[model samples]
Every structure is written in structure tokens, then in C-alpha cells.
Target: SQTIHQWPATLVQPVGSPLSLECTVEGTSNPNLYWYRQAAGRGLQLLFYSVGIGQISSEVPQNLSASRPQDRQFILSSKKLLLSDSGFYLCAWSGLADTQYFGPGTRLTVL
Candidate 1:
């Protein structure tokens, strides 16, 4: 019974501010974790992924970064926000298969 959860469901921030988003999974161990972003009417873009704790791979070079502090916790952060950074942020987990289960996501708006 693995479940994923993301915080703050929605966020609104001004440009140049700092941002922090968190995700956590329950009932799982050593799962592959991922972070993604989806713009308005656009497809998902993988931002970062982790195969294990402290082992992260960045898929897209952007203004964001991710960290795995615990076995089931992932955190996404930005030093400074930008208007273009506004989008739907998603956290996902997968086993050995190709199927990925995603969280509800966090909608971010930059103004």
C-alpha cells in the first residue's frame, strides 16, 4: 500500500523569491523517485530523479534542484524563482517497471 503525497497543493510567489516543495512516499523502500514539471497545455518534463538516497540525476537543466534526505522523502528547491518557473510540479515513484505513480502535484504561479 504505497502512497505519495505533495505539499501545499498550490503556491503563489513573486519573482526572485525562494521556493521549497516537498514529497514523501509511504509503504515503500528503495523506490525510484522523480520530479517533473508541466506547463499550461504542455507535456511533462522530467527535472530530476533519484535511484537512491543522495544519488540524483538531472534530466533538464533549469532553475530547480532536488534532494533525497531520507529513504522516502524528496525535496525540490529553487534559490530564486522566475516567472517562467510557474507550472504544475509533480513527484512520482516507480518500481522496476516502467509504470510510474504520481502524486497530486503542486500548482505554482509566479507573479
Candidate 2:
């Protein structure tokens, strides 16, 4: 029974602030980890993914970055956020090619 946890379910930040969101999985090992951002009416866009420790693949480049330091811990960071950076941040995990489970997601709004 693997599960993921994401913090600060919602956040409000200024135009130029640092951001950090963490996600972790329990009851699984070496699972595929991914970070995605979804706008109001768009599809799920992959930001980053990791197959193993220190092995990451970036699907899209932006002000955000992802790191997988441990087997089950992933961190999303930003040195300075932008107005376009505001959206729904989702952390997901998959053991195979066809299925993935998403977290509750973080709604970030910048002013």
C-alpha cells in the first residue's frame, strides 16, 4: 500500500518569492516520481521525472526544478517564483508505464 503526501495544500505568494514543496512515498521502492502542473482548463503537463536516485528527466523547462535525493523523497524548488508559475502542482508516482496516481495537488497563486 503506497501513498504520497504533499504539504501546504494551498499557497499564496508574491511575484518574487522562493518556493519549496515536498512529496514522499511510503511502501514502495524505486518507483517513478514525477512533477506536473495543470492550468485551469489544460492537460497535465510534465515538468520533471525520476527513474532513480539522482536520475531525472525534465519534460519542460521553467522556473521550477526537481530533485530526487532519496528513494522515495522528491522536492520541487524555485529560487524566485513568477506570476506564470502559479498553478496546480501535482506529485505523482507510477510503477509501470500505463498507470499513475496523483496527489491532492497544491494550488499556488502569485500576485
Candidate 3:
């Protein structure tokens, strides 16, 4: 029974502040992890992904970065966030079949 967890389900931050979002999976190992962002009424945009620990791939070059510090742990961070960075952040894990199972997303608002 694999399950994904994300923290601080909703956040409101000032512009130019730092951001840190974490995602971890239970009951799985070496799963392909991904980070996605969706603006209000927009489609999900792939941000980053990892096939294994310490192996991260960026799909979009933006103000954000991701790291896999452990087998089932993924972290998304930003040194300074932009107003455009506010959105719904989703963390997902996929198996060999490539069907992504998402965690409850984190909603961010920048003011």
C-alpha cells in the first residue's frame, strides 16, 4: 500500500521569500518521483523529476529546484520565490507502468 505525503497543505507567503516543500512515499522504493505545478485554471506543468536518489532532472527552468535526498524522499526548494511561483504544487510517484499517483497538493499564494 504505497502512499505519498506532502506538508503544509496551504501556504501564503510574501514575494521574494524562501520556499521548501517536501514529499515522501511509504511502501515503495526507487520510484520515479515528479514535481508539477498548476496555475489557477491552467494545466499541470512538469517542474522536476527523479528516477533515483540524487538523480534529478529539470523539465522547466524556473526559480525552483528539486532534490532526492533519500530513496523515497523528494524536496522542492527555492532560494527566493517569485509571485509567479504561486500555484498548486503536486508531488507524484510512478511505477514501471508509468501511472502517476499524486499526493494532496500544496496550494501557494504569493502577495
Q: Model 3: what TM-score?
A: 0.98
Per-residue alpha-carbon lDDT of model 2 for 1-111, expressed as tens digits?
989999779999998899999999888888999999999888999999999999989998789988999999889989999999999999999986759989889999988
Give candidate 1's error at residue 67 in angstroms.
0.4
Model 2 misplacement above 4 A:
none
Report clash pairs, candidate 3.
none
What's model 2's TM-score? 0.95
Give candidate 1 misplaced runs (Cα > 4 Å).
none
Query: Any idea what lDDT model 2 has?
Result: 0.91
Candidate 3 per-residue C-alpha lDDT over 1-111 given as tens digits, one digit per residue, 9 for 90 to 100? 999999879999899899999999999878999999999999999999999999999998899999999999999999898999999999999988879999999999989
Model 3 ranges off by over 4 Å: none
Flag the better candidate by TM-score, 1 or 2.
Answer: 1
